[model samples]
Target: EYPDATATDPTIVPFGPQEGESLSNCSTKFLERIRDWCVNKDALPQTVDVIKLLLVERKKAECRVPTHPPKDESTGDVPRAIVEAQQDEIQFPDEESK
Candidate 1:
């Protein structure tokens, strides 16, 4: 279950601007909130997957920036086992049927 809070609760704050904000700013704030939520012990696999996808997309975008320096050609692909291990660290176990 989610945290219990009433409308008058001061600590139950919104993550970002309420109105007239740019889409990019809103998106960034939303991602930050999701990342924080994903740190909880009960986070679902789907939540972790969303964070991973966001990270990979961000890296790809950074690489595509015109003014950014290029990556060195000498670096090679990450080993499959290492990649799997990293995923395991973040991933949740399969959910049981309700």
Candidate 2:
């Protein structure tokens, strides 16, 4: 028999912008809050983890594209993974700003 489980609800907090405000710092704070709630057994743990993961993934996607393209204007077929991996090893300076 299912008993009434309406006694539980989570308190939501909002983020503020100011000095030292950055995505990394904000994400860490958000995860800590989620951990506090989960450790106290106030909310679902998996949901919080998924949200954290999504924020991290979105940041990665946004950073993957170059803010400035190479000067050659050649859109090569190489996958981003290979380019990123070789970037440091090959030491090719960015041609975009030239």
Candidate 3:
């Protein structure tokens, strides 16, 4: 019965902030923006590169913010170097950015 129930599938949806969860951050929004933009943009690889560069630059720029020190704000966030490495690992279908 359970298998049959799932077999007749209707529309499925992702559960998140819209469904009443505490979801709010730049990273989440950044990923969503990238996904949407890449859908219609040409040269996917170049687009991805631009996104990664923008992300890294943003992090670096924020590091120099005078109001709040980066150390204190990012005590639990991923290390910038690791984040950059992960960005490099990002692979799209065509691998056009290389």
Using TM-score as the measure, which candidate wins? 3
Checking candidate 3 for backbone clashes, the offending pairs are 45-97
Worst 10 residues of 3 by lDDT: 13-22
> Residues 54-98, candidate 2, lDDT per residue (tens digit)?
576646744653544333336554444334433423233355733
Per-residue lDDT over 36-86 for candidate 3, one digit per residue giving the tens place of the 0 to 100 score: 667867558878695777567556644543332133254765434333333
Report the alpha-carbon TM-score of model 3 versus the true structure: 0.34
- Report the number of clashing residue pairs per model: 0, 0, 1
lDDT (10s digit) by residue, model 1, range 48-77: 686676667555644443342333357865
- Superposed by TM-score, candidate 3 places the C-alpha of residue 30 at a distance from the truth, in angstroms, of 1.6
RMSD of each: 16.5, 13.8, 14.6
Q: How high is the lDDT of residue 96 in model 2? A: 70
Q: Model 2, which residues run further than 4 Å from truth?
A: 1-10, 15-20, 42-98
* Candidate 3 residue-wise lDDT at 37: 68
User: CA lDDT, every prediction?
Assistant: 0.48, 0.49, 0.44
Off by over 4 Å in 3: 1-24, 64-98
lDDT of 1: 0.48
